[model samples]
Target: MGEVLVLTAAAGVPDAAAAGVAGRATRLAPGAIEVALDRPLPAGFAVPGVDANVVPAERRRKRLLIADMDSTIIGVECIDELADFAGVKAEVAAITERAMRGELDFEAALDARVALLAGLPESVLGECYAERVRLNPGARTLVRTMAALGAETALISGGFSYFTGRVAADAGFARNQANTLLVEGGRLTGRVARPILGRAAKLAALEAITAERGIGVADAIAVGDGANDLDMVRAAGIGVAYHAKPALAAEADARLEHSDLTALLALQGIAADAWVD
Candidate 1:
């Protein structure tokens, strides 16, 4: 079907209007706006208070979505909770805070934190996954909406694959990718495998997923909440930082400080009431 796409110019970096095209213009970012309409837009039309340009909507791609797990899809930090299980919540949380804030080196800090959990029994991993992890509000609605729209979804995390795998299963993701926690004799070995998944790994996952799906980067949307997520979010057509760290929120293509994951549905022309949870 013919349609109109209102996009922002890379140079202009326009702001969103108080009300979107249909009613209120939702701000996707400093330079992006999401327009909702029942039909194709008239030529040269512009929504008042919103800088809109009309383009063929069919040209827009609709496949490949990459998302981060901890803090993005789920409300809690799986590793920190695992620390609590290991009786080192205070120490581990300190390092986690620094890493999330981009103050300490991520790879090194991750190693130190995991080392603290060295003697932790493998069973605590399941305890943390079961007792601590909860899906972020509206996460199911967001992922289901994307799948219904024909987008292939994947969950990538800097956290361990054990947890990411469970989250992916519960959240309807097509695949899951994450770091593996080294284990020996039913306890953490205090070390992670080489080529740890950090900023570059996250971005590379986006590229790999898109290529495997035969889709362009512009067709994908990536979401996350830490310094490590910056590269992936920036590379996708729509990169959202949901309740992210301050630095991440500042750089993301879209910021969701006040809303849940459901806010993303608006970007794809799905209204809140119409959203399927």
Candidate 2:
């Protein structure tokens, strides 16, 4: 199969840095390069500070975009924010840290954290949405550009649908999927709906959406920063670990260490000038 190396940076990758790398190169952006490989890129061949990908020519631009919400799209962890409202931020955040790091089982950790918010006023959900939730940089552009091109965008998160729904609408996704939080009489029921949407659920969502769109997982590009996202991330044609945890970043096909979410666009050959509003 044909191959290409995309080298990208937030600050810009210089021409000198492109030396000794194989391929006939074109600049995809001020900070990105698209190198048409004469042969496969050497193992361990990497630039000092740019994100690089050795992708097949046919897999360059994906038709399906499946993204993870929470830390991937939004700036804060939804549970951690709710924990803060419940006066258990430190305790819950500790579990969140380990869970994301792959040190703890995600489902059990989510259960434990959600349990700490037992009896919290349901109004805090709206309060957290209004006061603490903010989309990450480049979130809108990625979704808009993909949708504008006739590709489908879906936001699947391990977080609650409450936030995903709002984020999906604002970020321009065509659909969204997330777990449901059980609430009662203006307070948390100290429980979430059963069959929690953990790692397996994320992969299933990706599969179901790709099938609906008449594409395989290889036609989709998935991005996330958590351990529960590992399956979906690895299954996608292009899996990105965006400011990710150690376990994920170590295994993902691409790592967005320097660039923001828009970097995914550059990776797919979409330039800033061509980005949709």
Candidate that would win on TM-score: 2
Off by over 4 Å in 1: 1-62, 272-274
- Candidate 1 yields a Cα-based lDDT of 0.75
Ten consecutive residues with minimal summed lDDT in candidate 1?
A: 9-18
Tens-digit lDDT track of model 2 for 1-277: 6877888887887877668877788887787878888987678887888887777777678898899998899889999999999999999999999999999988899899999999999889999999999989889988999999889899999889999999999999999988889998989988889889989999999999989888999989999998889999999999999999988998888998877788888778887788886
Q: Candidates' lDDT values, in order?
A: 0.75, 0.88
* Residues 1-277 of candidate 1: C-alpha lDDT, one tens digit per residue: 5543444423333544323344334455443556545555555555443334333345344477688999999988888898888889999998988888889888998899989889888988888888889898778877877887788988999999999899998888878898999999999898899889988899998998888888888888788998888889888877777778986877876666655666565445454455566
